[model samples]
Target chain A: MADRREPLHLIKSRRDSALATLVSGVPYLAWLGIRFDRRGDELTAILPYDEKLIGNPLLPAIHGGVTAAFLEVTAIIELAWAGLWEEMESGRIVPDAAVDSAMPRLPKTIDFTVDYLRSGLPRDAYARARIVRSGRRYASVQVEAWQDNRARLLAQATGHFLMPQG
Target chain B: MPQGPDLTDRDQTRIAQQFIEAIPHARALGMRVDALGEGTATISMPWAEHLVGDPRSGVVHGGVVSALMDTCCGAAVMSHPAGPASTATIDLRIDYMRAARQGQRITATAECYHMTRTVAFVRAIALDEDDGNPVAAATGAFTVEG
Candidate 1:
């Protein structure tokens, strides 16, 4: 119900932005167990290891598409969060009612590229995103996914997403 | 250098079926092998409530089509006469033409367009009811290694 939607008062930062919580509601994100967390300026995605995500029964690695989707989702979240951060920094006060109705700020992914650096073992994988440049029309983001060590990235992705209208 | 006489059609289908079976995520989305041809594969995914991107619109998510395209491309590589040992997606780019109709089974077909020793190139199209009109199209490269 509109009365029960997440309040926009939480838009102090990307971590608290309504988009962060609204992401969990997306069916694919919910079913894939993709969780978003904010570490300083970076938005990180945690993908729970599931047998259904496996691509090769031999290496037993998570499906490439799964990793790709993870990175893609991270980029969108990062962008939307950044947009909220910009609004907050601008000193515009968004009322609580408007926040509830405008919480789902998902951007459309225009193009995405995912490169497998190594085999993703069957374990929880973490991904972090960096928005290169964002404007009124589009945003470019880079994301990395790693297993045990951040230095040992299993995959990297660069993508462009269409931002919402002015 | 993984090369030999390719797996027979039956063998390829069995391997593809196993590939689909082993991937729990694929099964979760109701993915299945629909057909196979020389250097090409068609995969189908039934629409489920969980696959919807916009709850209000009830349209299938673009990522679902991306998954179908990627998995179908991998299958296309394995069916190649080059004898794909094991392959991983190197890079993929998809152009979403439109959202797929809800409650319809979407089918995707991928073809191995080119291959080298260590890499393979593929193109895929996803459609709902009209085979001529695609909801999305994708191009990507895959790691072809023994």
Candidate 2:
């Protein structure tokens, strides 16, 4: 049992640390107060409500651009996590050491489309990204964001990215 | 684009300024309205270290460009001859042509190309110092409310 638990423990800590490093690399993500929650290989991004994120004062809704930004961040980070999984599983990268150096170059955005279905209320928002197709040089991701209900999405986005060259 | 009654230049400036001031995100980014016509608007924001996406590249994030374009498009819709009192994005598509250079002001110009009873269509482009090259381009549909 102890033996069985060892690699799982390593995987969890390493994954968390690696993600932390990636999140910290982007100054804008920090400025927007975006954080990630990891469930094994899946990640859910969280954007806590802040007054500075409001775009329409009368509606008191979150800025459309902020919603797009959150979705894009989710897609990029999810893509990075997916690519980093193999290396982490194989122990190619040192556990919790030199994470910044081992950081995979983030994919660049090619294009992004966002659909605002509903006004984003002035509250915390959550998002998840699904990779539709990830190729050697390109990737497509779909993201959904919601404020209160997971079933009802406030916004959704589809983004294409150019993968970093090895 | 069909012509609607245009606001005076002074009225345009005042209204545009009030619109930007009411938006928290626009104020946070220090977005300024440079020009406003009957159905066109131009907005610009200066570079700041906090807005950088990649430290090594020192490039502003794509989101900043998106926000600028979105705001500019909405401003154009609001200034249209139809005179939408407010607007909300229905959908927006952004194409990032190139990474914006750091330490330069980025400007976006948007045109309300079409309008219907309740919908407005807009297109916008963002540029830095490079006169001909654009950092990003965007097209969007927004709800028109009076």
Candidate 3:
């Protein structure tokens, strides 16, 4: 059988580099082996199924947090691919950084609302994000999850990117 | 404030503090309680370095968004008179209208539209400081478990 596993690629750009450094320290996501694959305006990420992510052992449902996380990441990456990263770095956006950033001036997720369309089972899941709208100051993105060709729609998220003034 | 059997100030404070303590990520994300009453609760979080997918360019991650919504809903449920109830989300639908600007602190306001003995229905919207337009909208159902 052909290898179905997609190779992981290091995210380019200074912001992505910093994000990778910070995310590596997360114990839970690190354990899940989440990998990102970027291609033009689209991004595909995989979250390997792990026992820790299961909410109910008997029913074998993935935790809602895990699903939310997966969807959130997918949307962020998609926005990055769409070229909204520059504005976000400048800190001229809404849903301001005070709530989302760990460090001063670093724009992080100020707020995110994810809708869980379906339950992620005990199987590995995949997510894809598409940029719904992108502008100089703000951008919007959408994401969906799939398992074995069935649409799981783990979650959908919308983000705001602030641009710096000259 | 309209007089109703809403969550008391003490109860709201306790639940907010508990929620901040219970979820490590939520705490790490710097989630703050804005208000809790009338079957509704609002929370705020600063955009952090790790929360962004591209730190140099500055775009926050969507995973963090979902986490915020989940936390808000959970807190909203706990703010109810039942006192610290455990919940499992049955369905959460999110609609993204725009991307959150980097360095912006996003706020989430969640309202428990309907609550019964076994289930709670909630809807939340995340918006920037101006609060002019919503970045995302979500509605979900939570099963209250003992």
Best by lDDT: 2
Candidate 1: Cα lDDT at A159:
85
In model 3, what lDDT does residue A25 have?
Answer: 36
- In model 3, what lDDT does residue B146 have? 71
As for TM-score, the candidate ahead, 2 or 3, is 2
Q: How many times do residue backbones clash in model 2?
A: 0
Q: List the residue pairs that clash in candidate 1.
A: A52-B24, A52-B25
Regarding DockQ, does 1 or 3 come out ahead?
1
lDDT of 3 by residue, A1-166 (tens): 2124423342234445434533443333454468765444345788888775654444657767678777666665455434444343443432223344432232234344555566667888898877666665655566778777744465555555443322
Residue A21's lDDT in candidate 2: 81
DockQ of each: 0.59, 0.85, 0.18
Off by over 4 Å in 1: A1-20, A88-100, B1-15
Question: What's the C-alpha lDDT at position A30 in model 2?
Answer: 95
Worst 10 contiguous positions by lDDT, candidate 1 chain B: B1-10
Residue lDDT tens for model 1, B1-146: 12235766567566677678777767777788887776799999899888776565788766677788889998888777888777888888888776788888899999999999999999998899866778888899998888
Q: Pick the candidate with the highest TM-score.
A: 2
Model 3, residue A111: what's the lDDT?
A: 46
> How many clashes show up per model?
2, 0, 50
Residue-by-residue lDDT tens digits, candidate 2, A1-166: 1235577767678778888888888899999999999888889999999999999888789999999999998998899888887777676764342544677888999999999999999999999999999999999999999989999999999999999898
- Write candidate 3's Cα lDDT for B20-96 as tens digits: 65454566567888888766888888986656554555656555666677778767876666653467787666666
